[model samples]
Target: MSRRIRVPFVLLLLVVAAVAPVGGAAATGSSDAGTVDVAGTADLDGTADADVTPDTAAGIATNHGGTIVRTTTFSLTPGEPGSVDATMRFDLPDGVPELTVGPFPDGVTVVDEGGFDREGDRYVRRDHGRAALTLRFDLPSEQLSTADVGIDTGDWAYVRVPYVPTEWSYYGDAPAFRGDAAVDGEGAVQGEWAYLGATETTTRSAGDLTVRYVRAAGDPDAPSPDAVFAGWNWLATRLGSGGRDRVTVFALPTPDAMEWRRSPGLASDEDGAAYVFSRAPATGTEPAWFHEFVHLLQGPEPSEGMEWYPEASATYYARLAALNLGASEYGTFREASTVEEPRNVRFTRRSSWRSPTDYRQGALALGAIDATVGAASDGDRRLADAHRRLRDDDRLTYDSFRDAAVAAGNGSAGAEADRVVDAPARHEFVDDGLAYADHAPDRDLDGDGLDLATEREHGTNPFLADTDGDGLDDPAELDRGSDPLAATRDADGNDDGEGSADEPDPKTVDSDGDGLSDVRERELGTDRKRADTDHDGLADGEEVEGVTDPLDPDTDGDDLGDGEERESGTDPLAEDTDGDGLPDGHEVHVGTDPADPDTDGDGVPDGEQHREESESDGEDVPTWSPRGVGEMVGDLVEDALELPRMVADVVRLLT
Candidate 1:
């Protein structure tokens, strides 16, 4: 397919750069539910009349941070095999106003303060006062025992925690010591603490999960799978963040897929596969992958707002990794090159076969920002340093990362922060005059074009061609042993053809992964690499809707292909197509086939060929043109010469 021209993020980036924020801030506020159910004490004196805004939760009292405080548990009561109450405690700041609380998620009812929101979710009573609010939502153990909660300050920050399904510890004490009876001959405590007791400590550990690549659907084979073990071990080790505690990975069969997650953002399943359809997955080795791993490790509290920063970090670092790996050289076609911008752009846009332009353009914009903005100081924008800091200090946030990036640029964090806050744009450094060809060596070493100033102003690359401006120099791709004409086909792939390359080669056949080569798909009109023709979700020989398969009876086996059914006019997948008692083809050959059932067994379908005959008309039919028949056979008559002399004389007269 022709590449789509990137609609130019330069404008968006530069505009964003002018007003980017100084620091990342969270929206504020929390909701309220009255009293501690277990204690039967009203934390709030009463409902105070006050308007609630996202900025702050009213009537809640807190002891510590000016924001709403939250805590988490590994398991709780509702999660128990047969419990009903799933509860969480919200410690509000002392001077907050009236606030309302509720049972989140669809279909839950709040028994105490009954009211429904526009979306039909339930909300409970409001509390006003100077103490902690203990809100409990009834959850049947049959449903999910655990649910996540968010304590939004409704202003600058929202605290979140996972509410497990078991009773929690209020005393903040260590687990009780267990008696150790079993001892070796040397007399040491044999079984130290068999089970972990109740506590609310966040453990930094590797996720416990496994994944495997299968050949196709219905293939029963498991081998060479990826598994996670040990506390944040290899993942952190690979990220170069030693001693890191937490890490998460959202694994999928491929990075450019759309169907994995229905929506954008991070999702952690029961088995710990954190599926993130929004962010682009890392492609390079070592440090680059580690850079992505860090983002997962951070588990940046999910918010629709803070999505951009993490992605910016990942893209920035990936470029750095490429630089470090000696894979990129900086210059021009014929000089040195640091980035394969076109490939980077192509892969980013087309990845997942969905949302092609948004991600790649966004990533490119960020890379440009890092390079140009970071260039003010002699390599100070220290993008790599920022990533290192993030991995080293797990608590580092978007604001902190931005600060590091600014420091590298020899700029004030406050100034850049304001820029970010005002405009969410990024800028790129480019010398537009020179055109770059596919696989062409970089030419401009000093980022200055010897070409015309107009070309430089336009940042135009003369070498870029093709009508739609897909950014590929069609002639160039063809020169480098690739098909320049077709959008899909290209050479350079494996025999199995299971994985598609960032670029596909077409000259050779066999794309379908079916042992057959491209020559076959061309002959059969099937995708050269894939054997399925007509795209009816089945291979050609297997089934064609209008065609039949002789080998398989029931022509269309309910479970068979159309080709199988088409061998005869009936659907192979179905027992019969016409609904006749007899099979289809039998009607054509079986003198009395049920396909055209008629009790009379007549040649016509009974009534169509009625037994009536036209009555003989009384009028005589005129017969003429004896001469026409005679003229036609006069030559034969002459050859036979059986006619008398008078006949011969008549024939001669006519001739």
Candidate 2:
């Protein structure tokens, strides 16, 4: 079975904090409920809203460099095996309008808000003054098994500490957590983070990047830390990003019962760290790593309004980077980007974290933007330039990103982006940029005269000389008034009217019912529609089967019918088969042996005899020689007399 689990940060927090019941619901015991309490003092000086400059527009905040020190503890009582108790304690800045905390994890029931009221998932603090607040909730312990937070399994405790952001701002640094964390009254010490689910923690440095791998004790099949570092370095180089100072990757065992958190999984934090869980070892070439690395390179989310860009960019670049690194092929990325998904909703309006369709649509839109940029700039710019600009920009928003793209590309690229990204419906764009990046437009794969780009433009197969598998090549078909798209045609070059039924393919079969197949006709340079290409007296089948030329009516040019020559047992190619002065046809008409040069044992040749007879009569008397005339006269005399003795004597004399 295969499962895909998307554990978005905001969603995870909501699930964690909202499990407590509102009123009078019995508190499920700690065993059944997984309780996590997070306490942190507000660093008001580092608030993103306070850090915003005058030039920043309303509702926009600046980056907050200061960190909040948070301590989150999970406690579960022994009574209920699956329940949990969760409490969140944090201080709000003085003069702030309101303090909001969660969109917490599900299965969390909010039982108490410490005098604060609930507005959506957050505990509303309307006092607008400096104060400490605590919100309590109950959640199912099973949820902890999937959550990146530490899990306590009685004998061992495992936890993934992620920087959970408060709901009030988008630009604050990830809160720092205490190294010494506890679960169920047992103290837990920080262990090195694993790389790709290895049993031991291994660290390696390459260039400016440092990578850490953490694995459980028994699993020894995880990838080596050095290998992981090398892979990361390769990716970084290809992506054109300087290496980060530190990147921690956790390789955890594949959760058995949690189908929601199966292998082939990757989730990253605001800090340059990731938790990758899979049934198999992690490789840098995997799409999971490529995707997460894209996130790392993108840094943190810059603004709430631009929530969709990071994931979208990550999804799009994962495939692109894979292609560049030779980890994937063009067809793979093309297929992924061009998949048909429902486009009823705008890509930006769709939830980036929860919906896969939004990612796909956004990737497709980015592909279109990239192609447009590359085309308009003549290779001067691409989608990566926009991403680089976005990474460097302090105030990031959709408009800012769009402007960056426009600056990198031309006006047409901006228009393309608007058409694909800002439109109400998602549109799929061609991946020609990726497909033909390394080739010229005129490169022909099948050696058909038409280039690949032209073939694509004309809706013909670039890999095939004849796209429809017709007897004619694509260029020939185009030149000779044939439809390259249709394989079947009638005698007049119209569709064969077979509709959906199985009919003979014109490319493979002789549609005109001619003796020659279509391929043979093409090879012979004969008319496929007409059996006798030269309009000869003989049928094409007879001419071909009899070793005669179908393109020429008289192959021998002997003034004799080829068929007649065959009947007379004479060579059709020879004018006179017997080397006689008379032609084979003339000899046959004259009732002389064509193979014999002389007849009646006469010293003169048959041709001489025929010529003498013709000259004597001043006409063409080929069979009227003196001997033949005397024999004919004697036969007439015998018949007239009807006298047996005289007829016998004349016949003997004539013989």
Candidate 3:
């Protein structure tokens, strides 16, 4: 219950501080997908290639050895309050590539183009030498500065319009460059969040994911990039995402609060970019930036049924990430997950969504599924496991979600998932710590100092004390750097049984058959391998149960231990066995029966005699003297015999 930050956590904080943010550069690059997706709640076609390493600069073409498959140049001009002017140029050396453009959400006009004819929804550039394209963005439909694509302030332009890099046919055979595409980045910026102005950017990396923050030159009051990076690192690591090369987070700072809506931000998973206003969320509980940042990790193929998934996951993961970082409490998370919407409206109608019910309730279902699977597995898996499955599947459904849960946990877990999916908290319980203590096996049944959840998390058996048969319990194995799941070798790769020779028997919790387990023995500083640690007639188990000192043979500091006083019975925890005003230990020391009040039975109790002797050294207090009392009894017996003889003599004389 005493919570102190562990050494590893302290070291992680230090690491986060060590990788400080630096002033960097920002560039422009457009993500080429079949369809255009905005940051609010839309989706693009392609999922990011996690393996592809970007140039570390924001939107530079991905580096795959060296090859030239496609080249694009993007230039942006800061225009009106909510729009920007952009120009895109591409070098078409070999053949004419598909130049997809236009059909934007109104307010976008094709200002000019060198050699292109307008097709139905796209522009057809017939020439192959060089293509020049320009467009004016007046995103009147978007809220002040919320859109990720075309956001223009009075002085700076921050946008990631797919139209910017008009052609992305080369990004793959890799997303920005195709086969042997030795792409050249001249004065162009890189990454999804492009800042068009004479302003420097800042880049920070946590794990493998790097975030480039684009700001107008010398904009102070930005949150320390490291502060946010650490949270992302914790969440991403838990989700099994290592380093994800680099992503862009364009932090647009508003001097006047009225300039942009509070906490306005958006992210593109395809482009790995998030453009958010530098302001806290309305309520601190929901962090808008974290929510936007989490969007970079997820991309759902737009299907009709689970349309609410991306938003739900983002919302839940943002809260979860905060919870794990200690920024929020578990109650908040659980409450947020609890469904308040109508059961039929939310659960029955999959296609239709009602805000809190569909998104928040869906999150709750995910939370419940995670808890069930994690508890069933003893903590080896989480919702992220199922999430990865859902993310990979072409179509998302309750059945697929159920299958993923079952695969991650077990059949029962999947059933729990379905039960929760249908209605919140119906059949199974939910706990982030995986507290399935009431389950059949019972948590910590083996009593090896680890709970069932911890054992399952470590791949150890919940029922078995020694999972690896390594003569050490799982916890002891871990302490000695031995693998809890492997027994063939020790921590140092010593296979000759040398490491386990001195350890207690891991085969049983009570190695020495004492009532206390080995772990408990160690805690009490008792010898776990010895049943009688104190070497008294009483076993250590009995001593502990009786609340006597296990380290001392005489628990009450009495000279006579229970073994010596067993013939007549004695209290090991009590000083006076007979309660005759003398300690049992003193009676034994003074040559008297400790279990009895009288040793000689001369009408003087032995304890009283000892007390009297101690008071007068046997020279005074005759009433308390044992020898004097014995002589007096002998004389009384002699007088009785003489009286009987005299009575017989008197009767003879009368006759």
Judging by lDDT against the true structure, name the best candidate: 3
> Where is the poorest 10-residue window by lDDT in model 1?
1-10
Q: Residue 555 in candidate 2 has what lDDT?
A: 71
Report RMSD (Å) for each prediction in the order shown. 30.9, 33.7, 33.2
TM-score of 2: 0.44
Model 2, position 394, has a per-residue lDDT of 58
Model 2 local distance difference test score: 0.50
lDDT ranking of the models: 3, 2, 1
User: Taking the tens digit of each residue's C-alpha lDDT, what string does model 2 give over 1-655?
Assistant: 1011122222111112232121111111000011112211122222121222222336343333332323344454345444434444444332223345555554445566764677776665554333333322333333333343434332223443332334432222222222222244532223221121114677776335666656555645455555445546655543444224666665545445545333344444333555554344333223665576566666424453455666677677766655544455445656667766545444443331235654677677777778666655655457776776665565467777678779878775676666666655546546343222423466675567987567644445555566666566778666655555547665655453323332344456563456666566656655454565544456566677777787655577666667676666777777787786888767766677666777544556678877665343343334745666786896577456646744675674333
Instruction: Tell me the whole-model lDDT of each prediction, alpha carbons only.
Output: 0.30, 0.50, 0.53
What candidate 3 gets wrong by more than 4 Å, as runs, is 1-35, 39-83, 97-105, 117-124, 139-149, 162-193, 198-208, 213-217, 242-244, 255-263, 281-283, 299-304, 338-342, 345-349, 388-397, 422-655
Lowest-scoring 10 consecutive residues by lDDT in candidate 2?
24-33
Ranking by TM-score: 3, 2, 1
lDDT of 3 by residue, 589-634 (tens): 5556667676665667666665556433333223334655676886
Model with the higher TM-score, candidate 1 or 3 = 3
lDDT-wise, the better of 1 and 2 is: 2
TM-scores of all predicted structures: 0.28, 0.44, 0.49
Candidate 1: C-alpha lDDT:
0.30
